[model samples]
Target: MDAMIPLAQFLWLAGALLAAGLATGILAGLFGIGGGAIIVPVLFEVFAAVGVAPELRMHLAVGTSLAIIIPTALRSYAAHRARSAVRADALRRWALPVVLGVVAGTALASVSPDRVLKFAFVAFAALMSGRLLFGRDHWTLGEQLPGRALMSAYGFGVGLSSPLIGISGGGIASVIMTLYRVPIHQAIATSAGLGVLIAIPGALGYVLGGWPHMAELPPLSLGYVSVPGAVLVGSVATLAAPLGARLAHAFTKRQLEVAFGLYLLIVGARFAWQLVA
Candidate 1:
């Protein structure tokens, strides 16, 4: 009983989480993401408001974000796959390497400082933004996806980087596929599947990695992952995801690219400011 939060505060946080979930679901669908980018930032604010310690805040946000992403990623991927947009062959190829990469990333999280994670997030976000905003159709690594060795390498990179940024590997995977001449829609759909791969393992990793810091976290927490956050956010996210997938099909490729690029740019800048400030 002593550990329970005030009912009023809990309600307020619930409202916020639900609102963020709706937005996150929409973006996840539209961008083929697991909504972790949006989730991490929103959870950071929520945790801070509730007095989660500074050192543990980012880890909690990231861990909770991954947990919330599971359902959203599944929903988005299902919606995309139903539309016949997913590149199943590529997904099959990347699956094993991606899982391995996530394992490595999770291990890294156990020893890395929070600042390092934030920096990685900022750097990759900026890279994704720049590629979307400034890259031309002519710019590509090749006209087709490379052989197994290179594809595995790419999958590994996506897995490794996603945990640091609290994403489900959608942004990185989408960008890679597009570079190899996959249609934007196809790439996005395929990337949505990557979220499923990244989130499951990433969430578990965060839980284990943050176990030692449990005393510094809020109540109802599973290590760094917030059970409440996941439940509250995941509920609305799943419902809203289909709508976003529908809307994504309505937009042109350039429009989607521009919108996603702007979104990432803004997010990246905010995190960058946090680092400097």
Candidate 2:
């Protein structure tokens, strides 16, 4: 990929991707997001600048983001685990269903129109922003988490939506945990763990699902996943993840919520603009 790009242009894109990685890592650890909300939009523009077709850019961005999340999510989860913040039991229950969901969603994406994915990204980001920004503590779905069947359903939903939106399942999982009355910090940490589950399979699924389209992708591509995009962003993001986790413990719950909400709002707005324009 670097061989094909002119030195100046390659340097420019590398800097942009590295910068995005820094922010993505921080957001991952700080807010327990997979940072796909950040990566997708940034990569979308990057892919466009690189001459990726309009119809293929979103899928490529999404597939690449999931690949990047693999390492970042693991590092973030480890950092949060050191603080004893993860909900291990919930992760165990969600494991199978979430993987299955990723498989299902990846299959769907292979056949679905690009608009379907772009719309999903916009809608999920908006819904998450609304929940974080305006939701009150009284917004409990129940006193405790639901039964296995319901829990599985939630996990499946997280899995299904995550690949579509290019996230690691953190956004939806954290929201669901909070709705079940889990502490925000714990929910965030657990979501980091859930990200591992979402990212690995999601990335793999995208690669396989996109096999038929390999010829349409940019150079050094593996199916929909861009080798350069993953390496450039994932490497920096992994190193920065621990720092974000440490910072996460320093902020008050409301402060964290507000920051995450505002960030999501900006991302959502950016995509909405793209759709309208």
Candidate 3:
């Protein structure tokens, strides 16, 4: 179960969720953020305003964000596949480990304290965003993509940390692949695919693990997910995602990176403010 809110709060949260979904989906397609970098902080604020307990706010936010990501990720994945931008071989190689990692992440989140998860989300977001925005213009750990074993480890880490912060593992994946000399577009597209991987299992994990907390949840919630929230947000996000993929095609990598960096800077500033607040 997730947070509980009055009808008025519910209405406000739903509206915000839809907007967040729209923006998050587009950002996901364009920058491999899986929408959580945006959604997580926004959800925290929304839930806080709605009177969710301080200690439970981050958990509910992460769980609910994962729920909404399902359709958004799928739409982005389809769009990328249509463009043939995804690196299928890498996805295939990384799939198993990634799934295992999702389970691990969810299990840990189930037991994790709220503040820990919140700051983890903040720190992780800052790290990945900073990496994308400020890392060397042309950096490579290897001349080519890493070997299967190494890639598997990378995927595992992405999956493990992604759900912890309410993401699709895409941000980390894109950074790793791009740094390893993968084309930025291909890295982004494959990260969309990876987003799907993270969303599906990650959502289910949240649902199952969180089911017992019904007393704390809003009406119609399934585990930490507000079903209404998912439907409202997912609808717009699903629609917007393909459009984002299309838009992404129009931008040069440098331009995209600059835009993404600016976006992260804004997000980081918000987190910094929250830390002090």
Estimated TM-score for each candidate: 0.85, 0.84, 0.82
User: Candidates sorted by TM-score, descending order?
Assistant: 1, 2, 3
> Regarding lDDT, does 1 or 2 come out ahead?
2
- Candidate 1, residue 191: lDDT: 90
Lowest lDDT 10-residue stretch of candidate 2: 3-12
List CA RMSD, all candidates.
3.0, 3.4, 4.1
* lDDT: the better of candidates 1 and 3: 1
Give the candidate order by descending lDDT.
2, 1, 3
lDDT of 3 by residue, 19-89 (tens): 76677667767763557776777677766766777767777888888987787689889999999999999
lDDT of 2 by residue, 1-277 (tens): 7665656555666776788778777777788555688789878888888777888999999999999888878988999999999988898899999989988998898788788898898798788889878988787888778989999999999999999988988878887888888887998899999899889988888898788888777766898898878998887777777899899999998899889888888877877877789
Name the lDDT of candidate 2. Answer: 0.85
Superior candidate under TM-score, 1 versus 3: 1
**Superposed model 3: Cα runs more than 4 Å off:** 1-9, 15-34, 237-277
lDDT at residue 253 of model 3 (Cα atoms): 82
Candidate 1 per-residue C-alpha lDDT over 69-120 given as tens digits, one digit per residue, 9 for 90 to 100 = 7876888899999999999989999999999999998788768877777788
Compare candidates 2 and 3 on lDDT and give the better one.
2
Q: What C-alpha lDDT values do all the predictions have?
A: 0.83, 0.85, 0.78
Residue pairs in steric clash, candidate 3? 1-223
